[model samples]
Target: MNLFENAIKLRGFLAEDAKVPPSDGITEDAFSVLFLALMSGTWDIATNEWAPRTTVHRVVCPGPWFCGFTRGMKRGDYVEVEGELYIHDYDRPVVVEGERSTAKRYVSEIRAIQVRKLDRPLLVIDTGEDG
Candidate 1:
């Protein structure tokens, strides 16, 4: 098989190995709501203050701390978030300075891990589910 098929097979094996029995719900990070919003093309514009668009398809909670903590994450660190997503708009693009834009969207989660990039303020959001 080709590389893609190999990767898929490997992923299935990894999932089987990593799978754990579901536990009682854990507290998820707040930013997960924002994550969902960016993916679903929606945002909260209701408050129009800290989250000026309070009415957004707000995915990832985007808590005050999450926003602040992104500055502190290192190359190997992981962040966690828990929240829901709105389904209003996804107009503003998730633009990385150099990387090409993607059609893929964000998903909801309780927590995330942020892998730091060299010489950049943004971190790759490790949704715990996806890389």
Candidate 2:
């Protein structure tokens, strides 16, 4: 028996509106792509301070169902995503030491299974007084 899984769940703000390829007379076959930015922090033992980090992930949502579902999403909107991890490889032109060359680039993205828009929590001010 063999067991293997590749899954990811992320909650973050949308970096920008969902992008889709221009219609080629077939709108129902387009794929919706989303850029999600997640923030995190870690305590540095040596520096004794907090280190902040932000990771941007590309999420691909396929089919007309996902496209319509994500149509209302925009930049700065908080959302949750569940998906499988996938790595895509492509060739890109790069200049190396003043020489133009085509290089293979690999990008890791999530193939979204589900997506949900989440309401952000409001900040509350606390005063040290009994009501």
Candidate 3:
């Protein structure tokens, strides 16, 4: 199987309330909305084995199916987000003096596919239910 098949789950409080903006794509109409924000701080590494493998922070933008939950979410509220992991390399233009060069910028991002608010005990839980 490919690396993308390995999905990870993260539980943390949002740095701020999610921002919902109308979709800008040509395919998207007025009904579209996006949830964009950062899942701040660090994952509870001691509680689970997956927490230690992730970065301290993650830029989360849940897909359309999960966007509804963002409307009532507030900063500091607990949330559980599931996403596929991928490492992206971007070419950033850097200039020293007058010469310009492109530098490789690597970013570890999780493209969130599903998100849910956590109201019960424990940061991470296996619901034992499938989609």
Pick the TM-score winner: 2
Q: Give the least accurate 10-residue stretch of model 3, judged by summed lDDT.
A: 25-34
Model 2 spans > 4 angstroms off: 20-26, 95-101, 123-131
Poorest stretch of ten by lDDT in candidate 1: 6-15
Query: Residue 79 of candidate 3: its Cα lDDT?
Result: 72
The residue ranges of model 1 lying beyond 4 angstroms of the native Cα positions read 1-63, 90-131
Over 4 Å off in model 3, which ranges?
Answer: 1-4, 23-56, 120-131
Ranking by lDDT, best first? Answer: 2, 3, 1
Please give each candidate's TM-score: 0.21, 0.78, 0.58
Backbone clashes counted, model 2: 0
Model 3 lDDT, full chain set: 0.60
Residues 1-131 of candidate 1 have per-residue lDDT tens digits of 55532110000000011111123322343332221212123445795533322111222324444444443333222223332223332434456887656455544233323312234235477577664
Best by lDDT: 2
Error of 2 at 57 (Å): 0.7
Q: Rate the local accuracy (lDDT) of all candidates.
A: 0.30, 0.88, 0.60
Best first by TM-score, ranked:
2, 3, 1
Clashes of 1: 46
